[model samples]
Target: MRSDRRTQLLRRGRNVECASLVYNIIEVAVSLTAGFATGSSALISWGVDSIVEGNSAAFMVWRLHGEAAGISEREVLKRKKTALGVLSAAFSIAVVFILYEAISKFISGETASLSWWGIGILLVSLVVNPLLAWGKYRYGKLTDSPTLKYDAIDTIICEYQTIVVLVGIAFVQWKGWWWADPVAALLIVPYVAWEAFHAGRDAYQVDLDASVSG
Candidate 1:
């Protein structure tokens, strides 16, 4: 009975991870291209957010599979921490670039080209992200998998972050307040940093078998 429950939870994790991977891949391509062409900070931030989402998905694949395989403590800990380190670095770099571009674009008074594709990506993310997050979160609860849970939280955060970015984009497109996009994009940096920092801390705790949460 106990074994069956764990197996079911891991299966659910895999399903959610697969879904996340597909969505992230599609969003990244569109948002990155659109952001660069339009010089829109909000679009760019969403692009970065997509990358993070993809990373989370990739992490989920490993975690879900590891759980399925009944991963050893030492190996799981090492893999989890390594993933966290790499992901945190990627996020930090993105924040730096987003802040720099947002400021530069605002000061230069350049208007980003608004496209329907950007809006479409935002809409897709709004639905897909929450769905994925909820799926992973529930399974994580059942099995007590921190990695799975964190990935879901990251997904949800991406959803919120994207919405915030879109709001900025809307203001720019509607009111021509170019600065609002950048400011709003900048506002999310602190929260992203906080999430990344906590992820790192959790990763470091792996050696102690904190992955089991007991």
Candidate 2:
């Protein structure tokens, strides 16, 4: 790419950072409210995921400053792995707590409130994630930035996860399966754990420049 194109691409990526942040904040607010309204652990878990995603995007913005320059693919992969591992462990613990709650709710036969709020938030997610992903991917292609590309991937995954959870939420409304909501929430464990391990593995494999500061 020519110098002008590279500069333009960087500017586009910088603009996307703000867009990503906006999406993150919206997701967090809606998820938390939806989770509370429904008393659905899955919805709550999605909120948790949103928080971390926000942090991830924020960190990316910091790393993508004009002065930050570019990093090697290996370093980006390492950071990605670290992100996965850290988030996975956190999510796993949250899932376990939700499972315990599910068991208690099951035994007590507690009924949950049917919340359109949760569904509404999810619908918002379905739209926001895809749009953010499209933006991230477009900039990624223009910049050849692996981090932006990975963000796109993460957005897609989050969208899929929401869809999965949405099914459970919908089932709860349609069939009165309270257990289904939490069960769907726990279902994310395997995927989260898998991503975590890959993240940790990649992070540990890196050789950070000894002369550089963290």
Candidate 3:
């Protein structure tokens, strides 16, 4: 019975991660298109962030599936470390790209045009991302999976990015504050960098634990 329950939980976790991956893909396409259309640095950066999150979701899917397949404990640990390393690298790349885009906009004095599409998508994300995060958190705790927990935190960070980008776009539309867009993009940097640090640290810790166990 216990084994069956564990199997069920792993199945559910995979479902949630699959859903997250699909959503992130759609988000990337839409956000990039809207960002280019309106010249919004925030939207572009959000799209890049989505790519990073999508990769994380993919990693979780792989990890959960591997567990369900009864992979060796050592193999599982190795996969976990690899997933964390990839996640950290992906986030680091996002930070660099977003920073460059935001700073370039500021230096060039580029102003984004109002984008109802971007606003509309962000509003939808405000509703969608929280539910996904909640699902991840619930299953993460139930299954005692640190990777799922980390992915949940990443999802929450995406929610924060949505709010920041939405406000930036709103200000550009209403207050004519062109700088708000780049500022919002800049704001996303700290959050992404923080996550990158945590992922890297966790990966290193996992390596130490493995070495000691060996």
Best lDDT goes to which candidate?
3
RMSD of each: 2.1, 4.2, 2.4
lDDT of 2 by residue, 131-158 (tens): 8889888888877777678777878998
Clashing pairs in 1: none
lDDT per residue (tens digit) for residues 29-142 in model 3:
999999989899999999999999899899889988887777767777888889889989999999999999999999998899977777778889999999999999989898
Candidate 1 lDDT over 1-214, as tens digits, reads: 2386777778778888988888898998998888887887778877887887788788767766775777666566666777787777777777787778788877898777797888888888898888889998888888787777878778887878888988888888899887887887787788777866876776666564544441
The full ranking of all candidates by TM-score, starting with the best, is 3, 1, 2
Runs with alpha carbons beyond 4 Å of true place in candidate 3? 208-214
Cα error, residue 119 of model 2, in Å, equals 1.3
Record all residue pairs in model 2 with backbone atoms less than 3 Å apart, i.e. clashing: 81-199
TM-score quality measure for candidate 1: 0.91
lDDT of 1 at 210: 48
TM-score of every model versus the real structure: 0.91, 0.79, 0.94
Off by over 4 Å in 1: 208-211
